[model samples]
Target: MEHPVLIAIRRAAFTPLGWFAPGPADHAPENAKFLILIGNTGPEMFRRFARESGVATKLDAWTREAVSGLAADLGATAVYPFDTDPPWPFLSWARRGGAGHVSPLGLNIHSVYGLWHAYRAALLFPVVFDLTPPSPGSHPCETCVGRPCLSACPVGAFDGAGYDVQACAKHLAREEGQACMARGCLARHACPVGQGFAYAPAQASYHMRAFLGARQEE
Candidate 1:
């Protein structure tokens, strides 16, 4: 049976990975038994939600407000993406809980949303409930004989060594990267699972632009 709190969480944002597990006590309430990891399923819904919210101008701020507001309504504490005080290990936590796995491309591959998704917020709950853990059933990349994702990158960003962040950014800055920028990461779309939830072109472009812009600022 689904926990009532989990249902309420879905009303605001998609809970891609959720489980009954205790995290660092200082970051969570006493005896926290449930962790609901929220994220954007696709760009369209998130953009619309932000527009309707009429909150902060920046995307990060809007998401923080939305997630925090939801948490407040439930009387639960909210952990944000930018929380670096204790430095939450979101990717590691997602993998350990079976909600996501490390793909050959060095990206997190979700069972239902694949790699074309983003982590937004996390909610810790005190009460435990009968629920199924989010598992990437059968590990999509494990059974595959040919790893197309590794080869799909135009700049070889996913070469065996690991993802080359600098190389990818350079390529995206050039005209050649427009295709990827418009349609999302090629390696991500090459995944056999969760193609249905792939981001629309506009959404992909928005994210790609944001990604490059952030890198430039650094």
Candidate 2:
């Protein structure tokens, strides 16, 4: 059975990706014994986000607010990936929890959600729950390689080693990138891992536009 806390989070539209007990080296909250990584896997979260009437701008602020609100009820401290004041080690946390691995595109790829998933907030609780530990599933990028993600980009933005942000941004803002803009990331779409859990077209477009907007703001 899923823990009440995780179930509550899912009810609120966030997927609890995985969890782990923080080691001494992990700079977690003083009394935090456990951490549950949470994020969106598909469009349900986006649907909820869209339904909520807000000029709250980016999904970051909204996710932080939602998770923090839920955390309070569960007596947990909610930390976000967007928190930069002290900088939370989300990537390391994800790796430790076995929820993700660094993929060729430089994005964290989940065995279940592939490149379509993203870490939103992590819940830190003082007590550990009786939940099964996440297994480090077979990496999707490994075995049977015709890595289409490497060649899917029109501007060759993702080259396994690094991503060309400027080139990607320029493409996204132009007519030539309309297919990607209208649907989703070309490279992300090429990944066969979790196509079943892929984001819906509308949700994909929103993120792409948001990405382009953020690049423009930068």
Off by over 4 Å in 1: 23-31, 53-56
lDDT of 2: 0.87
lDDT of 2 at 209: 87
lDDT (CA) per prediction: 0.74, 0.87
Q: After superposition, how far is residue 203 of candidate 2 from its true place, in Å?
A: 1.1
- The candidate 2 region of ten consecutive residues with least summed lDDT is 53-62
Write candidate 2's Cα lDDT for 38-149 as tens digits: 9998887888888884434678878877888889988999988888887998888988888978899989999888888899988999998888888769887887389999
What lDDT, from 0 to 1, does candidate 1 have? 0.74
Model 2 lDDT at residue 36: 93
